[model samples]
Target: MDRGGLVVELGPGAGGTTRAILDALPPDGRLLSIELNPHLHRLVEAIPDRRLIAHRGSACELPAVLAAHGFAAADAVVSGIPFSTMPRAVGARTAAAIAECLAADGRFVAYQASARVAELCSPHLGTPRVDTELLNFPPMRVFRWERTGG
Candidate 1:
C-alpha cells in the first residue's frame, strides 16, 4: 500500500478486512468502504477511523462514489462481495466500473467462494492470478488482477 494511496473496499461485512486495511494503511491514506447492507454499513461506520468513509450503497455505483469523495482513481480495490450470487448483469457492470475507476496499474483483489468474479472481470481487467486459502472453512479463492495497457 502506498503511503497516501486511496483504497476502495466493497462488502466490508463485519469489517474484519476493513480493520486489517486500516492497520496497514498509512495515516495519510484514505479508505472508502462500500457495503450494501445498511446494518453492515453501520458496523463499519462504528469503526473510529478518520481515514475511513463508510458508504452504504451498491458496488455498481463505485465510480459515482469515488467522484463524490473527490477521488479520481483508486490505488487498489478490494472486494468481498458474493459475485456468484449477484445477477450477471450487475456483476458485469460492477466489474467494469471497478476497472474503469482504478488508477493505471492499480490492483483489484477479490475473495470469493466461486470463480464467477473472474468470468465477469477478466474481459475488462485481464486475467487474474488466483490463490486458494485452505485454512478457511470450505476454502476461499483469492483473485487478483492488475491494470495494464490502456
Candidate 2:
C-alpha cells in the first residue's frame, strides 16, 4: 500500500491477513475488511486498530460496502474467498464488484487453491499474473491484476 491509501480485503477468514494488512498500513491509511461469516467477522473486529473497519457482509457487495464506509475507491484489494467453491454467478458478481470499486492503477490479489478466481475475474480485470506458493500447506495460487485508466 501507499502509506495512507485505502485497501479493501475480502473474506478475512480468521483475521490473520487483516492483522498483516494493518501492520503494513500507515496511521492514516484505511482497511475495510468484509467477512461473510459472523464468527470470522468477530475475530477481525477484535483487532484493536483505528484504521481497520471490519464489516460482516458478502464480497459480492464490495462496491456497496465501500460506499457505505465512505470510501470512493480502494488502492488495493486482497481476497481469500473460495472462488472455486462459490456458485458461478456469485463469483462473477463479486469479481465485477471488485473491479468497479478499485482505483485506477489499483491492484487486486487473490490467494486461492485453484484458478477459478482468475477465470472469473479475467473479464473485468484482464489477465492476472499467476504464481504458486509452494510453502503454503497444499500449495496455493496467487493471482494479481492491476487496473489501468479507471
Candidate 3:
C-alpha cells in the first residue's frame, strides 16, 4: 500500500491496525494514534516505528490533540472504537471529533461488527458509505464518512 498523506487512527486497540498503517505510510508520512485504554496504549507503544506516535487519550479530544502534535488536519482517520458498546453520548462525541479533525476530502473509516452505521454516526457524521467485510471476525462492516462542511 502506498502512503499518501497524514493519517490519524483512533482507538487502535492492540496495535493490529497500527502495524498495518506503519507499513503503509511513506518514509516521510506521519501516523498519529489515540488510544483511551492504558493497556492498549502500552501495547501499541511496543511497536517500533518512527512515524507512529501513540497517545493515551480520548478520541473526543482529537482536534486539540492533533493540533498539539502539529497536525492541522488529517488525510485519513481510521477508528476501531467499540461504537456498538459505547453510550450514545460517548459515540457522538467521538464521531464529532473525528469529523472535525478530518480534511474536507479526508476519509473517516470505522470498523464495526453491526450494520448500524447511521444510528451510531448520524449525530456527528453527515452521510456515510458502508461496506461489508466478511473476512473480519463476526463479519464486520467498514463505514467510510466524508465531512460536508458541518
Compose the digit string of candidate 3's lDDT tens values, residues 1-150: 255578998898999999998887899888999999999899998888888888999988998999899888988888888887777688778777776778877778888886554575666666778888988778878888876553
Q: What is the lDDT of residue 120 in candidate 3?
A: 59
Top of the candidates by lDDT: 1
Give each model's clash number: 0, 0, 0
Number of clashes found in candidate 2: 0
The sequence of per-residue lDDT tens digits that candidate 1 reaches over residues 16-135 is: 999999999998999999999999999999999999999999999999999998999999999999999999899999999998899997999999999999999999888899999999
Ranking by lDDT: 1, 2, 3
lDDT of 1: 0.94
lDDT of each: 0.94, 0.92, 0.82
Candidate 2, residues 63-118, lDDT tens digits: the string is 88988988899999999999999999999999999989989989999999999999
